[model samples]
Target chain A: MAIVAQTSRFSKIAWPVVAWIVGLIFFFPIFYMVMTSFKTDADAVNPEFLFSFTPTLENYANMTDNYDYWRFATNSIITSVFATLFALVVGVPCAYSMAFSPTRSTKDILMWMLSTKMLPAAAVLYPMTFLTKNVLGVFDTHFLVIVVLCLINLPIVVWMLFTYFKDIPKDIIEAGQMDGLNTWGEIKEILIPLAWGGIVSTALLTFIFCWNEAYWTVRLTTIDAATLSKLIEGNRAPEGLFFGRLSAVSTAAVGPIIVLGWFCQKQLVQGLTFGAVK
Target chain B: MANRTIPRILQTPAVILLLIWMLVPLSLTLFYSFIRYVLNSTVRPEWMTPSFSNWRGFGNYEFVLNSKDFWFAVKNSIFIVTSILTLTVVLGVLIAVLINRSFPGRGIVRVLLISPFFVMPAVNAVLWINMLLDPVLGLQGIAVNNINTLIGGLQDAPIVGWFFNMWPVFEPISFRATQTSSIAVIMMVTWQWTPFAVLIFMTSLQSEDQQQKEAAILDGASRWSQFRFLTLPHLGRPMAIVVMIQAIFHLSLYAEIEIVSRGNGNKNLPYLIGEFANNNIGAASATGIFAVILANIVAIFLLRMVGKTLME
Candidate 1:
């Protein structure tokens, strides 16, 4: 009995230490990037100043002169904001109907929506470019980026809303109906208020997805509508020359999203797995 | 009757929008795949325009099939996805179990661990390739140089000099090389995705039946046996979900491959298709179709699993 207790005591201390070590190791790159951003370009590469150097704000101050950081950042904000709002606008009602009034075919329809998401974006790259650039003449436009981002994220948005809506008991909606509320009134007055938290998280997750989206955003945009993703991709091979400024911009690009991600960590499993795991 | 009409009216816009989004570009891709189209062809200006007269039928598919890059991309795609899936699931299960119990600073650990998942893929790739993994000035190079210098200094010491002399000079690997680019991509993506798997598994772990575990302990079951019997079975569903979700995402990885080596040594299907789309429209479309077919194979199973839990 004493031996068992001793072993358990040993494990208790050993395991948490291991866990802390692992967490720090995983976070070291981001920590290093943030640390590097305060150094000058020369100090960033010089081994003599690797850990001990006079930190400066030059990288953040010169961010615009070096990379035109604000323009791409503004574009990222514009596209991701509009895309999240549009997805909520389109997704809310569809999820509302499916959750409340699901038909025999509703399950199949939901599955079909998810299946559309599975179709590789690479498969239609040229066609989308052809149609957008030639047929519609909207390539590299913010409108085009907004529409594409909205469409790519709509399925997940709807799926998340559906799962959230499913949890709100039918009696609440029925009671609202008995109050002589119209269909729109039931949704606006009853459903949205009851599901406000879910709706907000769904929007948050969708916005994060849009912000981090690299494939279509990079492919579809040039100078006019390029987001931070495109800006980073453009400077992919800096040849280690501008590590300080590059790290600063990169940190700026992802900093807010990482903070936002912490709040939605719980919702993420439901959002990404379509609630199948939980 | 009124009830049904209102719901249908509410759903029409979303349905139609998605239908158009899926069908239009895909059908265009299908049409282009059968024709010999090119962006700029001075010798055959007629072939530059996509029309039925330029129809190549299976010729484009045959051409893509015959290319060495297509096969390499397929093999590399499979290698990358499987490696990431394997590493993330294993690490995820272990980490989730580690932090599952109440710890002093568990919340901070989770936040730190999950931060990587939110880093944009472009930045993830660039941060890794240039700042973290670069052989000359990156952390890898610095660390390697420090170790070599330490060994050099220790070699001159009195008694332990012979042991230190036997150690060869440490060399930092250049991850941008043709042979190591894929490994670099796998490392970065695994870092980004393991947190995702951990979050999912931890959520599942919270719902695990503690009564069964206590019962096993009462039955004198060892820690290994208890984990094997109760926890592993409980985690099976989430593990499967993680694998399928990650498979769908990583199979079409583009930004990482592009930024890593610029498709120098690690071209996946999406990267290959991007290359073809530069001028060879027909081949690009055909390759795109192949990518769709591959994605669908995985999608079928995922949809099946998600569908089972839909109405429930």
Candidate 2:
């Protein structure tokens, strides 16, 4: 009894402390980046002022003049928002059909869509560039980035919507149909409200992905319509200085998404795991 | 069930979009692969433009197969993917278990733990390679230098002075080196993705049979045995899901590798393909086909598992 009591008491303290320490350790790098952002570039690399430097807003202040930060920031916002909207616009109807009225090949179609995602972007890199640059002439344009983002995320968007739509009872939709509602009406008036939470979270996750997408956005864009990902990748080799400005830009790039992510951590698991775990 | 037309119409747009997205570029790649295409060949400029006249059946494939770089890239891609998979899963399980129980500030802990997942890959690579893993300029360098200075000062102490003097000076390790570049990629990717694995495993943990766990406790099972026997078995499916999901992501990892060392000695298949595309379009296309095959091989298992999820 004493041993059990002692072990229980020990664990009661041990587990929480361990969890907190691990959490802090994991968060330290991000914290360091944010902290470094407030230092001047010179002080950023100086060990003498490591933890005691005078924090400044000089880096963020000169962001636009120094790196053309706003252009990239605007491009990121435009592409991500439009891509998320387009994906949902296309995905909802497809998921609705699969959920409410699955056909003989619905399962196959869903699997096939997921399979498309597994297609490596690199495999078609040359062709995509060739087609966009020479044939289609949409290279480095917002239209191209938006379309690419929507296409790549469309499968996951559809899958997420399908999973959410599956949870709604068919009887509800049938009743709505009996009440003289068409398919569009059913989706807008009935299905959406029922799955509003799922749809919003899906959009959030997709937007986050489009924002963080480094591969196509980098490869397709040179100067026009480049994103924050392109900004950081271009400036990857800072040559020992510019750490302050770099951190500021990175913080700006990821700050909104991380906060958004904190709100939807639960949905993230459900979406990424394909509702399999639950 | 009532009518197939509208449903098919609704799905048609999606189908057609993906079909074009998948087929058009890929077919172009396939066509280019069969031709002896190159961007700049002063000796044989006729090979510049892709044409039927330049058709070289099986030649590009044979060239790719014979290349030593191709084998190194395949080996490295597999190594990076497997290393990252093992690290994320093991660390995910441990961290998920650690924070499973209700505790003080669990919400904040969860926030901090999961923050890394939201970091952009570009930022993750830049932050790690420049600010954290840099041998002379990063935090690791500064910390290592601090320890050495501390040791140097300690050499004057009375009792431990001799021990301190005997201790060798420490040197900070550079991750940008040929051999260690992939290790940097692995570390940063694991940091970003362990949170993902943790989130999935935590969700899975929540759905575990509490009553069965209690029964094990009543039957006098140790914590380790209870975890080993009951929890591990329950987590089997989620582990597989984590492994395959990560495999899908890490197989084509680019920004991280590019930023880390420009694929110096740690070239993966995708990096190899990128290198070839700079001049040798035919070789690039052939390598892309190989990558597609490799991807499909990993993806088949995941498709089966996900399809079954819906069937249930």
Q: Residues B1-312, candidate 2, lDDT per residue (tens digit)?
A: 578898998998899999999999999999999999999999999999999999999899999999999999999899999999999999999999999889999999999999999999999999999999888889999999999999999999999999999999999998988788989999999999999999999999998998887777777888899889998998999999999999989999999989987846778998999999999999999999999999899899988888787856
Query: How do all models score by TM-score?
Result: 0.98, 0.98
Give per-residue CA lDDT, model 2, range A25-89, as digits (tens).
89988999999999999998999988999999999999998899999999999999999999999
DockQ of candidate 2 compared with the true complex: 0.71
lDDT of 1 by residue, A1-278 (tens): 42243347778898889898889988999999999999999899998999999999999999999999999999999999999999999999999999999888899889989988999999999989988999999999999999999999999999999999999999899999989999889999999999999999999999999999999999999999999999999999999989999999999999999999999999999999999988
In terms of docking quality, how is candidate 1 classified? medium
10 residues in a row with least lDDT, candidate 2 chain A: A1-10
Clashing pairs in 2: none
What is candidate 1's TM-score for chain B alone? 0.98
lDDT, each prediction: 0.93, 0.93
Residue B258's lDDT within candidate 1 is 93
* Shift in Å, residue B174, candidate 2: 1.3
Q: What is each model's TM-score for chain A?
A: 0.97, 0.97
